[model samples]
Target chain A: MTTLAMTGRPLLQVEGLTHRYGSRIGCRDVTFDLWPGEVLGIVGESGSGKTTLLKCLSAQMEPHAGHVVYDTREDGPQDVFALSEPRRRLLMRTDWGIVHQHPVEGLRMKVSAGANVGERLMAVGARHYGEIRGAALDWLGRVEIARDRIDDMPRTFSGGMLQRLQIARNLVSRPRLVFMDEPTGSLDVSVQARLLDLLRGLVADLGLSVIVVTHDLAVARLLAHRLMVMRAGAVVEEGLTDQVLDDPQHPYTQLLVASILHP
Target chain B: MTASPSLSLAGIGKQFTLHVQGGVVLPVLAGVALDVAPGECVALHGPSGSGKSSLLRLVYGNYRAQAGSIAIRHRGQTIDVAAASAQTILKLRRYTLGYVSQFLRVIPRVPAIDVVAEPARAVGMTAAEAERRAERLLSRLRIPERLWSLPPATFSGGEQQRINLARGFVVDYPVLLLDEPTAALDADNRRTVVSLIHEAKARGTALLGIFHDAEVRDQVADRLFAMRPPSMAA
Candidate 1:
């Protein structure tokens, strides 16, 4: 059976999505459907408006035009931008998650790692401190953090550990759709590899629908099933990850792939 | 042996337009047609750059063909790979079609067993059962027990290829595409791959493969489809 037939409807659909910074175009005329459990990568070099598109999609910034329709658990397909502020806030805290490029931006530096994760559960109306703490501990273990480090402040954690903590914090609420802004961008190569592996496994196991923005093609290839290549605030190409990377029908894409320094 | 074809490609055409090089169009395959019936193995015979791998990729929905249709019989319905949505193609890849490329590409740091078992898990096999099948295939393919928990990145070329093979065979897909599956294998491993191909064909899987090794091709392939570079043929 087809995935469309199985899932019934797309988890998220972006129709002619356009965003702008004053007069400068951020991203233009972008449209795609994200199926359940699909990982769609947005790849471009610096200043390609990948982050801007992500912000608009995540409801952090309202787009100049177009619609972001999300299939809510309770409601059917609803325009994300048209929702009330409190409803949008609830959606972000409940069914949606946004992971920033920097862990510090996504985490509460003052709180302990366990509390950072537990806070999400709390926002989702989770009661009982013991239960929240228990879930936090379980999530910490899943992210490869040591049990002893549950009470440690996120500021004290290593860069990789902090990213993992941020991921755990975002994922504890069981969000169906996650918007990640270069989740592994700030880490070293080996650390990035480890975190990418963790994200890949978690995405598969949880069947999360993710839109990851990255400049690194290797990261996109590893985590994304499909890719959209952005250039000058517009999509130059979009296709299956291997198709876009290997055959690269677009000249910009070919240049990007050819520019990678092969070890 | 005359059962209907599980995979069919008709009037297929693919060409690469090199925009950077002054918009030059490189013709790869033109007006090609192919079919693989149930319980059959079709080998793609060609020299390098003859678009054998490209044909397989087109069938797998990795590379979109410029023209024509790739009709696959999946779950009692015919789905055109050329026109299918990304989600449909993904579902087809998961439940209907399986492809093993020449190289092993996987997320770094995932254990080799998990990499091999992922397809089976995607197709609804329990983690335990999928891991069991993965272990069996790895053992039969002669992967060391110690290496099962380690990533295949550091393994020898042949070992990595064997791991790829184990992954392809992990799930019993109705249609399979293999790209130089045994190219880097040793005699023993090659023998294992040949036997695996035979077993898959016996189970009625329609296979389209590029077996550069003549011996392996002769052993597993029921027929050969010769391909020449369209531009070079003229």
Candidate 2:
């Protein structure tokens, strides 16, 4: 479904979400509902609180104010901020997947590739040696890696492969809501394009609800079904992807769109 | 006798009962039928919530169907996926089905090479043979040699996706289901995936896929199936 269409039920709901780093506000009065299978792009320039807001939503940081309600697999709503640390972590491992901008931050460098991917499955309580190993291999191939390197460590992989591997690890169990912070920000242009395409397909195929924080309008335009433009810790504009990108209503949005440095 | 279609779905219907919503039943798909012949590729295209992914899951036996028969032919055996027992489905999946989705799922602490080689290992291939195949595919996909010994947990999105592709293709299953197989691949890597898919097709693999990229769809798909979202269709 088109994200802005409001057909599917909202998987995540944010209300008055405000956070601050000391005196500076990270995000102010942020409110939105992310529908199932929708990709919501939070776009802004660097230092626009996009990353800050993502951290708050992903439960990486505690917000000074606000409520982030997530629909659990059991069809019940849980306030993310209210959950205990262990419960929150369990949610992160089971129902939620997070992709970090820096690949290293998301992956465990000491573990082997197979273990990296397999850990997600194990986190969800998957046992049976043969089944686990086989699923791990299948996921490696799905992410485009060859199977022979299942025992290798993450330190040996290139930057691009590292990011891919992190994705494999995060997504192996098929999380319902995936929070991505500049998932392809460090990659080269060609690599970014490939990652974006892969992400779009995965989002669609899995019916995943994604909230991706990005400064690049192009990244938002290509992968996001809905756009939310943030500036100085506040949402300046929000709408459907085409409406927000092709025709801007706010002066700041107009400036952001106009300033896009096309390749 | 003529061989049955590689995959056949007849009057497939799926409805989800929303117990939380006063037991409301939403019909996601209904009266859907399709077939894929050996060496042919079929693509599913539709707006979001149109049940394209659901159909794939149904064929893969990940989702149970309310109505319909999903028959996949392998080794002259026509197994009805929708009604097959769990053990039957498991056996069929071990050797006959291959799926490539956008994300890669590997076991933690395993090497990238072993992750890719496990598919062949599942179907009774020798460990050595599977590892050799994994090496060749990894090199062909352009994964660095050094990474072969490392875990993919720290690899980038593109690299992880390549690992996933290698695993899916290693088994050379008779019926393959691909969901955006080349979405994360670069131009060169995309070309490599294309060739791999072509080779799979040449080997008489029956393929069903969903490609958001029109270029890739055109290059590989023999037909397209359009689906209407459940809301509209209902």
- Per-residue lDDT over A112-141 for candidate 2, one digit per residue giving the tens place of the 0 to 100 score: 999999989998999987888998898888
The lDDT values for all models are 0.92, 0.84
**In candidate 1 chain B, what residue range of length 10 has the lowest lDDT sum?**
B83-92
Give the Cα-based TM-score of candidate 2 against the true structure: 0.53
In terms of TM-score, the best-performing candidate is: 1
lDDT of 1 by residue, B181-224 (tens): 98888899889999999899999999999998999999999999
- Candidate 2 residue runs with Cα over 4 Å from true position: A1-8, B1-234
Tens digit of lDDT per residue, candidate 1, span A1-263? Answer: 23235557889999999988889999999898988889999999999999999999999999999999999999899999899999999999989989999999999999999999999999999999999999999999999999999999988899999999999999999999999999999999999998998999899889899999999999999999999999999999998888789889889998899889878
Q: What share of the true interface contacts does each candidate keep?
A: 0.47, 0.00
Best-fitting candidate, scored by lDDT: 1
Give the alpha carbon lDDT tens digit for every residue of B115-219 in model 2: 898778768789999999999999999999999988797899999999998888888899999988887778999889889989999999999998888888899
